[model samples]
Every structure is written in C-alpha cells, then in structure tokens.
Target: MSLEGFLAASARGGAIPWSEELRAAREFGLSAREVEAAAFGAGLLPARYSRNAGTIGLAGQAVLHASCVAVAGCGGIGGHVIEQLARLGVGTIVAVDPDVFEESNLNRQILATVENLGLPKVEAAALRARAINPAVILRPLRARLDSRNAPSLLEGADVVADGLDTISARLELAGACARLGLPFVHAGVAGWYAQASTQAPGSSSLSDIYGHGTAPAERGVEAALGNPSFTPALAASLEAAEVCKLLLGLSGTLRGRLLHLDLLAMECAEFPI
Candidate 1:
C-alpha cells in the first residue's frame, strides 16, 4: 500500500498496513515532498508544517512514526498530555486508566463531561485522540498499573508519561521502566501546586525527590482545601513539553531535576536530583 492508501485506510477505521510502506520506504527512500503529500492527505500534518516539512526529513519521520509511548493515566494531566503527543506526531500511544469519569471530574479532567460521566477515562481519551489524528494508534487499557502488568504495559514503549494519582503506582511504574531501560516523565498536580520531572535510565526518579513513595500532598490537602485549576494546567503543559523534547531528542529534558510551581505565589523552582 502507498502512504496515501495506508492513511486512507486508517481514516476508514482499518489497520495501519505497515508492510507496504516499510518496504517502499526502505527500498526507495521517500522524498520530503512525498512525505508531506502523504501527511497532508492523512490529515496528520497541518498547513503550517508544509513550509518546514523538509526539515523533519525521512529519518525524523521514521523515528516519529515508529516511536510508541505509554501514558498511565487519563485524568486532567494525562488527557492533555495525550493530546499534545498526538499533535506532535507520535505514532502510537497506550493510554491506561481504571477510573470512570465522574461529576466531580468536570472541574479539571479534560475527558470528563456530562455526556461522558459514566464512561471510562481511558476510552474517552482514546476517542478524543483518534478524532484529532486518526493515524495515531491508540491502545486504551481499562486497568490500573500493578506489578503483574507493569512489565507488559511498559513493553515496546519508548517513553512512559506519568499521570497516575497514587504514589504506589507511580513508584511501581518508575521501577518497571527503570528495569526495562525506558525513560519516564513524571507530573503531579493538586490544589495550587504542581511538579514535573523526567527520569532517564540510570538517573534519579520521582521517588528520589519526593521521598520514599509518598502520595502527592496536594491530593489529600486539596480534599479539604479544594484544588485550583491553575496547577494542573501548568504542570500538564510542562510535562507535555518535556515529552516533546525527549521524543525530538532535544536538550533540556528536565531529567535529573524537578520543576516545582506554586500558582498562588506565582513562584517556580527547580531542584536538582
């Protein structure tokens, strides 16, 4: 199948026929114009990218097309994180969340709406992400991350984006990714506070900075004090930016450091690992 054919099939809810493109792309390299034409036809690349389509050449296209990321939550931060990754041309995403959208989530959760109140968060997120870019392969898992499934979940992932709410799950995922040598991006939000960090293999992790697997203080405190919208958005955007940097192999990945933000105080700090 040609790249246009593959994209048309995807838009029609068919499998991504990789063999044809893989063979053709390897045998006779696709020109920048060809890639742009296919991407435009697939609705994957926007008009703005046309001017610089040659910039992300065949190698960059191959890397972006083959990379797969696992996102372990579908709440406020995770939903936005998924959106950003899709827009950035990540080819595949595994979205995991065991929770269902609730009335209370309307305040901050991006996938939460009155129509989707009873729907699973992961499912809603996948639907929205597919709507944005049908070419993206989204695997939505409606299960929580645990020791047994952690390895399988992290398998084949280039990076893991952390949006989990609980400390235990976060720690488990960090350890699992560490063992598998996959990089992980960590982000958390509660009340007027948010923090984010990237954990590369052989480097510090979320636990190293937050102490021994302690639950996010904001979760508990916010139950009594209430969560403000400012923190989640700020933290999620930073996390998304870090994910993009890592995917593009850019510098300043936030690795080995934590970015702390206090919305009420309008202050930000970076603590090294």
Candidate 2:
C-alpha cells in the first residue's frame, strides 16, 4: 500500500497510533521520523503527540517536526533540554559535547548513569532521546564546539541551545549564532538559581551580558555553588519552551529579555537586555 493510503487508513480520529506509525515505517523503509512527518503532511497527527496538539496545534506540530535544533552541551541543562525537545518532536537534534560522563555528572546531569559513566555525553543523550521518540532524529557530535567550527557545526540548525558551563564557550557560541543568523536559546544554572533567554542574531545579547573578550576563559557561578539536580531541569525547560516558540514562530519570546529564577525562594523575574 502507498504510504499516504496506509497512513490515512491507519489514522483514527485524525491521529495515527505509534504501532501503526512503526508498522508504516518498517513497511515503507523510512525512519519513524519520516513517517511522522508524512502523517503530519497528510493532515494526520501522531498519537504520541496528541497531548501536544492542543498547545502546539497541527501547524505548530508541523513546524516542530520540520525543525532542526543544535544542543551545545549534553550534560546537566543540555541533557534535560535534549530530552524535552525530543519529546516535543523536534525533527533533528544535533547534540554536541566532548566530555565523558564521570561520577560527578550523576548528581544533576540527566544523561549520566552509573553504567554509562565513561561514555561520551552526546552518545548517552542519543540513547535517551531515541528511547523517548524514535521519530526524532538524533545527531551526536562528540566534539567540542568552538569559534573555528561553530559555523559549520551549527549552520543548518534552526536554533542553537546553550548548555555550556563556561563563559568562553558561551560567548563563542553566542557570537557564532549571531554570525550564522541563528536564534540562540541560552540557559545557566547554579545551586538554586537559573537564567534563560533567547537571543537573535547580531543582538550582542550575550556580549552585553558577559562583555566581549574580557576573560573569555572564565567559568560561571555553577563552578562555585555547583549544580543541584533541579536547577538544570528548570533552566533547560525554559530553554526548550523558547525553542518551541521560536520554531513555531510564536511571539513573546525572551529575545532582548532575560528571565531569572530563584528556585530557592521560588521567585521569578524578567530583565530587559
């Protein structure tokens, strides 16, 4: 049967179940992600994404299913962000992280597990994401993101997500995203505090906040207070929401604004950039 016919026939109440999508993927020699996209293109929803329909809608789901996102770090905030984006059905995820999961990461990094302590963070993220949604493509780049490679490393992504811990790398990525004309969704976590924002290209938002070329190697406060398990998830959730907004072309994004969260006191504040 034709994929379209199969999808149309398999759909119930305008949505296709996972079992049917999987069967179609196997029958059509396509990835589950591709089949999901076909379902969307055919005006049918994937059942697993039914919960997302009300908020995302069919148009938003189509947008998200066609979007590609680059996650610069696969630990802590990065892991959580990747997981959220995967569940949210971003079509392709380019997960970049050079570090291995050491015992230290187990405290807050979602991708860190005792059995996979020595594995690369990107690989672990891929495993987790694939498990969550095989319809989401996982691209693992087990390399450091730097100025030299940032352009090529992130060129095709619709948005670049920040999960880096150092000022130097964040600045580099923010600058590269500016040059690449890509939107950057940034988040940082330390102890009970986290901040998130979306920066448009050439906004110099990160530069304005961190200053340009002034101690690029400096690490953020996470180095001092350390990341508890909650902060990264909090920050990454904000980042993932921003990503969804950007992909869906929705308004009220954090562009030119920074959101600060005091988890300890359960307070939230927004500051203009």
Candidate 3:
C-alpha cells in the first residue's frame, strides 16, 4: 500500500493500533513517523485530539506527539498528570514511583484499581498509559527518587513534574530539576485546596516559594483535612497544562508564580513568589 492507501485505510478504520500502522507504513516504504504524520493530515488519528489542534495547532500537536515528560510520583496528583499527558499525545512518559497501590490511593489516583492493589504504582501507571495510548512509550522506574538518583531516574525528559506527597520530597525533586536546568511543574493538594506552579531553572525554586522551613509539621495537611478525589485532580490538571505549554514553548507559564485553587470557595488566585 502507498502512503495515500494507508491514510485511506486509517480513515476507514478511524484508528489503527501502533503495530499495524507501522507494518502498513513499512509495506509502503515509509517511516512510522511519516505514516503518523500522514494519518494526522488525513484526519485519521481520531478526532479525539482534533479539539486540541485548534488551540495548539498541528505543529504544536506534532511537538507534543514527540515530547517526553517525566513524572516523579504516581499517587493522586502524579497518576492523573501522567494520564493527561498520555491522552494529550505526549510520545513518551517516564514514571517513577516506589510505592504500591493501596486502599487509600483509590480515591484520587487514576491508575489505582482494585485488581492492582498490590502492584507497583509505576506498573499501574505504565498499564494505564498503554491502555489509553498504545503508541505512547512508557518507562517505569520502581524506585524512590532522592537527590542521588534523581538525575539518572529522570534523565532525557524534556520536563519534569513534581507530584510527591511530602514537602521534603517535593523540595528534592525541584532541586534536581533546577540542577539539570529543566522546567518543573509542581503541584500539591490538601483538602479542598491545591497549588500549582512552573519553576524555570534560575527563576524561583520550590524552596524559594515555600521556604526551607516550610516542610509541614506532618507529612502533609491532607493527613488532617483529608485529600478528597477532586482536589488532586484539579491540581494535577493545572500541572499537566503547564507541562503542555512548556513543551510547546508557549508563554505565560507560572514560572515565578503559584496558582492556588480552593474548591471549597471555588476561587483561583495567582500570587508571585
């Protein structure tokens, strides 16, 4: 089949799995990426992402489809962030999480499931990404991230996401991103409130915004006020949007400011560091 023939076939199918798409493209002496581009041009990669084309354009969409994002943590915020990235056509996802799914995680963790109760969070994230976008390449690291291993664990990512549950871990992840000169999307949730920000290297670090002594008395206020299903979802959505903007080289990122959301009051406010 020629490129046109593959596009026509893709249109007729309305979607094609990655393997079949590659096989068909190879039969026509075309690269898989070229076939993917042809599919997009032919309007066969599913209209699901068509809405994004208007906002980000075909060029931006291509950028997203070729981008790689690393998510540190796979709990409530991280899981949702990773899911959104994959669904938005990020070509590769590097997810790091040492924990396993538990009953406590089902509330807001999109990758958590009853069947995966004992599975590693990174494994669950990988499975979720595969099920959502088979074409997405997911690299799961089932290990904790500290300053020592952060760089290697998060290597090669265009941007890094801070989805850690503890204040100290968040600080550590932010420091790693800064050292690597990578953009970081940081978010945290507690009860009905959540905050998000994009930290560009040399700008305001997470520590600069929250301060070194800002570590919560406890692991997080969520332990007391509780983390509802909605708070992390809202926060992670903002973080994902920031990552998308950064990946596409767009402006107006929350580089030196924090976006705070209060679901209880239904208000969103941004404040400078």
**lDDT by residue for model 2 (83-198), tens:** 99999999999999999999999998889999998999998999999899998889999999988999888868999999898887888888888888999899888899998888
Q: What is the TM-score of each candidate against the true structure?
A: 0.78, 0.96, 0.87
Candidate 2 has an lDDT of 0.90
**How many residue pairs clash (N, CA or C atoms closer than 3 angstroms) in each of the candidate models, in the order given?**
0, 0, 0
* Highest-scoring model, TM-score: 2
**What lDDT does the true structure give each of the candidates?**
0.73, 0.90, 0.81
Tens-place lDDT digits, model 1, residues 168-218:
678777877777788989987778888889999755476786665555442
Q: Model 2, clash count?
A: 0
Instruction: Judge candidate 3 against the unseen true structure and give its global Cα lDDT, from 0 to 1.
Output: 0.81
lDDT, candidate 3, 9-56, per-residue tens: 655345555666767666877665566667666656634466676687
User: After TM-score superposition, what is the CA distance of residue 58 in candidate 2 from its true location, in Å?
Assistant: 1.3
In model 1, the runs with Cα more than 4 Å from the true position are 1-62, 212-220
